[model samples]
Target: MRRVLALLLLLALPALAADRPPRSGLDYATPGVRAMQADDFANPGMLWVQEGLALWDRPGGMGGTSCASCHGRIEGFAGIAYPRRDPRDPDKLMNLETRIEKCRLDNMGAPPYGYESRELVALTAAVRHQARGRPVAVVEDADAIAAGEKEFRQRRGALDLACAQCHEANAGKKLRDETISEGQTNGFPAYRLRWQGVGSLHRRFQVCNQAVAAEPYPLGSQEYIALEWYLAKRGAGLLVETPAVRQ
Candidate 1:
């Protein structure tokens, strides 16, 4: 019965999407949370933004150079295009965090900030915050996009739910007192009230997997990175809203 229902839900996706186009998760935020997100001072995620700017200028490691040494300050930086196909390794897609890690290790002679660390998340948020208002731009990578879409629709976990069932099919509906969102990634690296701090898109993905009783993938894994790209593509043209506050 459950499987049949899931199949029916899958079949209904076209109609659902046609009726309601994709929208940011912010649309589902409460009035107070929405206000908090709009105000730079009120948003807790700004703390990470500040930290990231500081990290850019703060000298460190054997090279004794800050991120600003190469990329300049965060103030006038353009929006970052990530999950890009690596030039040297075409098969590998490099997300913002991985690129940061590589820069630290190769360019700065510093140890890479492990995934989800405070410093890394702060820097990622800070960079993204600079790109606020610019549309999300992703290069055409057919294979990765297809893989990501498959993952989005694939039912997993003990509950046997796919990401689309909630984020796509029931985006505006309430579930357990919380409104289901489109699971867009534009406002990622944002502050979540539940976390009381900023977090990355991949971290949220892990949380969702766990919520469904599935073993979550490791941070920075190819699977999650591909999904990140797919979400960006799905929400293409949406302005970057890094450090956005979410309930």
Candidate 2:
């Protein structure tokens, strides 16, 4: 019965999308939470932003260099085109965090930040803050985009569900005590009441995978990275809401 319902939902996607285009999860936030995200002064996430800014100028381990020493304070929406396919390695897509880590290991002689680390999260929040209101500008490579779309729509795991079954077909429908969300990615590196700290989009993906009893991919894995690009593309026109507060 459940699988039948999922099939029906899959068939209904075109009508569902046309009838009501997806919305960011922010639309599902409580009034209080929404206001928290709206007001930077009131948002706790700013602490990380500040931390990241401090790190940006501090001398790194090697050659006494800093991010600003090279990048010299990105003056515009520089990172908007991130997670891009590496020119030398077209199959590998590199996001801001990966680039940062590469600089640390190769240039600064520093260790990579562990997943969800305070320093890493803060830095990502700060960099993304530079493009707060700009839309995501990732270039869609054909192969990644196609595989990502397939992954987004395929069924798996104990529940036998696809991402589209909830985030696309039954978005806004009730699921237990919470309303289903479109699961958009514009407001990533967000603060969640459940986590009591900022988290990355990949972390959220892990959480969702656990919920469905599906095996979650490792952080920075090609599969999840492709999905991140796909989801970001889905929110092409929505503002990048870094350090966004969520519940």
Candidate 3:
């Protein structure tokens, strides 16, 4: 009987150890992340910023008129106050990138770039550059807020983990070498050293879902767009850092 009890205790020890939560560390929030929030304008990624600026002024596709021709100086147009509920379509909200595509199609008389395209990336970076100092303030009208919150809390994936499980509950905890952040969207279109390219929040989400063994949703899918709207609102006070910012 004594031998059996000891064997049972030994068998349960590994399970107990596996249940322990991850640890937190300063390394999780990299210096690049801090620099991005403090002063992204001075970051080396601003070279893309210049390219985006030029792209904004250049004509493309069937549209002879540049974004500059209609919107005038992009420097005066800020993009931080976005992800707002569209008055015409209350069921849908518009993020800065979405609004830019709409303007490109309607006002600039050009074909809209596909989501994650270089043209869209450049244009978004250029437009976001104008809002360098502005604090992010995505709208949180009742319906939009409710929908966003639902997406944030819902779990989907083979791992059975929701974004909230890591970003909200275990935020600051370490999973291997990387520390988890609050999953803020302030430093978007950021150049992650790991990725070797500038990418959008949606791209990051896809990577994260894959890491947890979740099926990745298509780019520009309604689910991702909704998630973007939610994340933008969640990081309302953070500043916009565009282009390929080093992570």
Candidate 4:
């Protein structure tokens, strides 16, 4: 009887391990957190939103024209669809944030905001706020989707892990303490307690890449942007809840 019991315990070990969920300090599924998931209109991140609004109207660079001079009232364009193919660059599509930066250079004749800069954060927050209450609707162009899918499946870093392994394959499996989510990006510029700061989806990707020991890409790089395109499309039908989220 003892010998039989030992064998049974050994057999169950793998099953128990497989059932465990990945652990993280973040509590994405808490009821309070879920309730705030789609509340961007009165977001606590509105401080950043205000900063972005100011930047939009402030004159800068040698051209001496503000973003408002060209784009008009930012509020008027709220909830407008994005991730459209760049008319100039057919190979790349422009997200709302990217378009705003491009306008800063082309129309406002100002330098692009640095990634992680207050200006960028404010701008992204502002643009995202405009989409408040609207379902995320990224384009599904074949080329863009294919590129994103390829990145999603590629194994990289010392961990030799692909995003799909955890998010798709082992979702809900415990690594230590917390449940794993689908690695969604519907809530961005989120105030992650872990990060202790606000960040964009691309920044999150960089952190994940580093965690797995992969080479980190520069922020706003074409590769990261392509990945964002893929992720945004994957998160389509979800609402945009920016600046106010906690992960």
Q: Which candidate achieves the best TM-score against the true structure?
A: 1
How much RMSD separates candidate 1 from the native structure? 3.3
Show the lowest summed lDDT stretch of 10 residues, model 3. 18-27
lDDT winner between candidates 3 and 4: 4
Candidate 1, poorest ten consecutive residues by summed lDDT: 13-22
- For model 3, residues 1-247, the per-residue Cα lDDT tens digits are 9999999997786466335442212125578665663565655556566778898889873648887777788877785466675668776667767787877786766788877887677677677767765676576676666676787777888898888778866677787887777677766766676776566667888998888899988765557777777777666656665543544
**TM-score of each model, paired residue for residue:** 0.92, 0.90, 0.78, 0.80
The digit string of per-residue lDDT tens for model 1 on 143-216 reads 99888888898899998999988888778899998998889999989899999999999999999999998889
Ranking by TM-score: 1, 2, 4, 3
Q: How does model 2 score by TM-score? A: 0.90
- Deviation in angstroms for 135 in model 2? 1.4
Error of 1 at 82 (Å): 0.9
- Candidate 4 lDDT, 1-247, residue by residue in tens: 9999999997776467445442222244666655654455534576777888898788885668887776789887666766677888897767666777787787667898877777887877787778766777676687877787788879999999988777766766775776667677766766665775667677888988998999988877667777777877766666776665665
lDDT of each: 0.88, 0.81, 0.69, 0.72
lDDT of 3: 0.69
Ranking of models by lDDT: 1, 2, 4, 3
